[model samples]
Target: MTEDAATIPIRPAELAAFLAARMCHDFISPASAIVSGLDLLEDPTAQDMREDAMGLIAASARKLADLLAFSRVAFGASASAETFDARELEKLARGVFGHMRAELDWQVEPAGVNKPAARTLLNLAQMAGAALPTGGSARVRAVEEAASIAIAVEATGPRARLRPEVLAGLRGEGPGEGLHGHWVQARYVNLFVGDAGGRVFADVAEERVTLAATIPA
Candidate 1:
């Protein structure tokens, strides 16, 4: 690591707490939408608006489900080594990013990946999705090794802000007391990777930030 990298300042915990609260806040809207849709279904007039209401309800439910599942792996209270299909991961990633306006250029190979590793990779994808504001493509890949798996996330588009804490998280650093949204994400990723006995590497170049992880099989 360069001196610049080593000297990267840590943010206050209050900031991290605030960022985490903000991220959770965003999910409340979708949960509320689901509730509204359910209430509409109970109304007699809803029969006429049934289709629209149902659509809203289904969309909200799916979004909530995706978010929850992603959170379970990204920010949840448990981390275990299990096996999951790569196709399922791709589907999950697509669903997570589908609501966004960005166009993700995702390519996932067919393979069975350890759950801990999968969760780590998913978190990275979520981070990438947040970075590309003007819309861009993110490439995700997993390579199975004899004793471990290597997962990589590469995103390219109009340059996006790459927070130092985000990079630190990938490099196995804790949240370090910052409340920035990105910092919270970094902490989440760091915890997930650590629980899985993995290491995260980040390469932030001129126009892109590439994150990769090596997880024990």
Candidate 2:
């Protein structure tokens, strides 16, 4: 069946570029902070603030490392591993959540998941964390349901909300007036899930947002 013109998939080149840009946006902040911290440490007149500089450097370094590791599995081709351990995925999710205001609750029932499901879990978990700008909790759950894997993330907080572009992306639509960084991740999840004979869903309510996907096992 032909896709509707308005909901056509993005071109390969465009999608790749958008994804790259989005990852860069995520990394640049902590990378720049590390640099700034180093600059402060080198300033002889600011020796009194040396401890502060070191603290900043250490925290930013950890955050940078965490984001990089999470991105590798969520967005990049994480080697040739066909299946990923659920425990490791939870660690990755926790690493990213440590720096965010939101908390993570990983409750995956499966011991392992295929490539597509792993990516979906990681991306949705991160997206759920993002939904809560203020403090909140993002619960990530995945289980084997017959011949498929069901993944759901519920984000609840003081002001939990899903971005407009994110909804559009999950529906396999373009960003329109939304931010590219947010839209690209959702679109990527949608593409991989659809390719694996699955679908993605998102629902927004007062102080809550839910994201879900199912991938054929």
Candidate 3:
């Protein structure tokens, strides 16, 4: 994406288009695999491949389900209700991360947070889950403050540095040149939290990276 293209004050139509396109790009891969798996299942001559194809189909279905659940809460208009409990987000987070090499340790309370805060928490968890390029663990925690809730997602593993492009995007500096898929989450988190009367911050360390947000009551 160009610097101009990535700049802020992104019109809602354009932002929605971009997110929809990106999400479709992500959704297509597993979905295609599932289709191919079904094709293989129909071929009686390929009986040897049926077991493998069935497994592939099952996994893809799970991923598609996860993507739908995550996208609904993260990008779609949620909060038709006043607040969303942590359990819903936790279930989605576990599904999202389960497909990855990393494990997710969820500590969010049933104590509800508003829709925006919940979205911020889910994005943080997604970002932390991806931070572990190699196999590791990600943890999502919620702390109830006097007037607000603090949401945090921490990833621990070797070579756990926040992507410079993601960090830059979070700071409103735009993702660096040659940016790709990962920059999208950072962009969304920054815009979403700011609009929700919240602040996005993070800590980068050699072994762990934590993305956090403070959302007001």
Candidate 4:
């Protein structure tokens, strides 16, 4: 076994803090853009560039909305035993993916429910979103099992980075290299799945990375 094969449960509080910080960082960019757009809207000559300014404002507002909704499902406190519509979750995943410049190809079942399953899907969506740098397709699907559910994220993109340590962390392994935001996210994903008694698998190659998780029924 190599260093990347060790398994460890990450500190939940720390992982939550990291995610909060990341969300804040991303929100700040669009928030600033919104402020700038507003300032421009108030200008006497703004009417000449009304279309452009309005576009900027709309884009920023959408980004903020996506971030808030996604973060709520990912890090916020919610009932773990409630039933949530799979279609609704799929829509949420699409919203999160919309913020990216990637070409996404997703297929989700009509309707389903399972809080753990929903959370797992959300994590998978976010992780796959990060893997695609040059904008590739991400496909997701879910199936009900005897006493659980299986969720998968198959992504293809240029410059995909699924390092061994990061993969290890996603598999409930020890702390991987924290050099990148993706790796940090992987650690949290690993912990979340592990805590729910689920497992994550990854197959990373030259131009593709596939991640999947199985959660209890």
The candidate that wins on lDDT is 2
Candidate 1 Cα RMSD (Å) = 5.2
Per-residue lDDT of model 1, residues 1-217, tens digit only: 3545334544557545655696687689799998898888899966888888899999998888887766665554235536766777777777789876556665655476766777776778877777677777777777777788888888777875467767766564544554356666666666567777787877887668788888888
Whole-model lDDT, candidate 1? 0.72
Candidate 4 deviation (Cα RMSD): 3.4
TM-score of each: 0.72, 0.96, 0.90, 0.84
Q: What is candidate 1's TM-score against the reference?
A: 0.72
Best-fitting candidate, measured by TM-score?
2
What lDDT does the true structure give each of the candidates?
0.72, 0.93, 0.81, 0.74
Summed over model 2, clashes come to 0
Model 3 alpha-carbon miss at residue 177, Å: 0.8
lDDT of 2: 0.93
lDDT, candidate 2, residue 95? Answer: 97
Please report, as a residue range, the 10-residue window in candidate 1 with the lowest summed lDDT.
1-10
Task: Residues 1-217, candidate 2: write the lDDT tens digits.
Answer: 8766447658999999999999999899999999999999999999999999999999999999999999999987499989999999999999999999999989999999999999999999999999999989999999999999999999999999999999999989888878888999999988988989999999999999999998998
- Stretches of candidate 1 off by over 4 Å are 1-23, 34-58, 77-81, 172-178
Q: What does candidate 3's lDDT look like per residue over 1-217, in tens digits?
A: 4446445455667556667787898799889999999999999899899889999999999899998888889877464865887788888888888888788898886478788888888888888877898868888888888888888888999877788878866765555573546676687788888887888998898899988889886
- Checking candidate 2 for backbone clashes, the offending pairs are none
List candidate 3 segments past 4 Å from native: 1-9, 77-79
Ranking by lDDT: 2, 3, 4, 1
Query: Which lDDT tens digits does candidate 4 get at residues 1-217?
Result: 4534245445668666766677788789889989888888899977788778889999999988987887777655254537777767777778888888665566666377566677778877777777887788888878777787888888887887666656766765654455434565677777767778888888888878898988887
